[model samples]
Target: MASALCCRARSVSSPILSSARIRRRLPLVGAFCVISLGLSNLCPSLSFKTGCAQSLPFVPLFKSKFSSQSQAKSSGSIRMASESNTVPSIVVYVTVPNKEEGKKLAESLVREKLAACVNRVPGIESVYQWQGEVQTDAEELLIIKTRESLLEALKEHVKANHPYDVPEVIALPITGGSTAYLEWLKNSTRD
Candidate 1:
């Protein structure tokens, strides 16, 4: 059945199977295979035969470095969450009108312990709609790094100190980074 499907896929020689078209569709095919494999594991009835993925050259098969328990135990570089005691870190962005306000806000955030570090990036242009009208303004961007636990306090502080009525304050999680830098960020911010 798997070979039949593979043959069918190869035999389809329409214009849609051209080089560029194949490139565009390969990702979708790979995603479908991944989802199919996951579903097959969850429901035994949907399982594909062992060589199904191998038959399709365009579909990528990914193997993790720690595929076996022995390999995982032997590796010293990879530490489990329970072992690391790591805290989640976040990077918050805030845009201000000018350099003066950006500098003031960055200093205040660091001084108040609301953020570990605030980087002031100048010469940014912002265009958005406000009060049913289009508006454009020159702005500076502030990148604040702190613990995820301090997000609410950080937002409140920015709201109070920012010059704009509706300040652009957005936070993005720092998924992974250098352990030393993450530790510094965690220690620098207030609990």
Candidate 2:
């Protein structure tokens, strides 16, 4: 029975993953989703239902509708194994002026519990367009890992502290990560 259920989940998961919407957001989300639905999408004949199974690693596929992380968190939008006690799974990469600024920003985020850790990678060369001309500058990058719940506050912290006219505040999702590490990430950043 357990093996059959795994097979069922794999079948439903394959197509649901091939869906048009999920591809763009983050394939990591798709990966977590595969674990969650556990072949539930294979049965389209079943009536559409409400609620989520993110806690069970076998939820209905239709519930994976929203593209934004906020929406996902609100509705049990993502799933993991029963053993999963992972914290949050979002990593935001930001560019700042210098090591001094980077460290300051990192310190602030940690102080506020907005991010677990903000690693300052210095001496990065960035090339981009500004005011109609292409430009290159040596910039420091702040790699911050935190829960999705803390992203908004993190952004606010960055905006207030960063010295750039428009700092790079792009974030990427962590789909399949160390279960223990994820739990640490959540615990470290909690306010």
Candidate 3:
């Protein structure tokens, strides 16, 4: 029975499969595995990729959306929330005509956890056209520091509480800045 397995041998044991044999056999196995992975990526039909499936190269069949840098940037400005250093993250510049009202609103936002903190700079002179009327007034400016994610909620809360029929709640993206400060902002504004 042992003699049939060997070309010629008495007490000599056979070496492992040759490198050429391994190379020839592996491609077939690799092809089978690739097909299996590809099949799992396709669902509902051959043409439609499921929500779980994405088109990327030289990576695993599945990867997280957060792992995709392009998606992260396009969704919103990506701030590296580095908690290691001391820096201030995104600070929204808020303008309101009344100092007292502005301070009140800022405090409310911070107390409600919509904002990490708010600082009021009183006595800002502003001139703008409202309802086709050019007007000038002494306005208070609020510097609000918080995470990028909470911008929407902050806007809504500000508008709801602000005295003006239309409030100035704008988010200017922080492209690059101190990483440590950004991290603090991210940490402070969590659900």
C-alpha TM-score for every candidate: 0.60, 0.57, 0.52
Q: Which candidate order results from sorting by TM-score in descending order?
A: 1, 2, 3
Rank the models by lDDT, top first. 1, 2, 3
Per-residue lDDT of model 2, residues 69-140, tens digit only? 344453342354124777546899999878888888889888888988888898999999999999999999
Q: After superposition, how far is residue 171 of candidate 3 from its true place, in Å?
A: 1.0
What is every candidate's alpha-carbon RMSD to the true fold? 9.9, 15.8, 18.1
lDDT of 1 by residue, 71-183 (tens): 44534333443246557888999999999999999999999998999998999999999999999999999999998999999899999998789999899987766667777
Query: By TM-score, is 1 or 3 better?
Result: 1
Top candidate, metric TM-score? 1
Displacement of the residue 174 alpha carbon in candidate 1, Å: 1.0
User: Where does candidate 3 stray beyond 4 Å?
Assistant: 1-89
Model 2 alpha-carbon miss at residue 44, Å = 32
Error of 3 at 75 (Å): 22
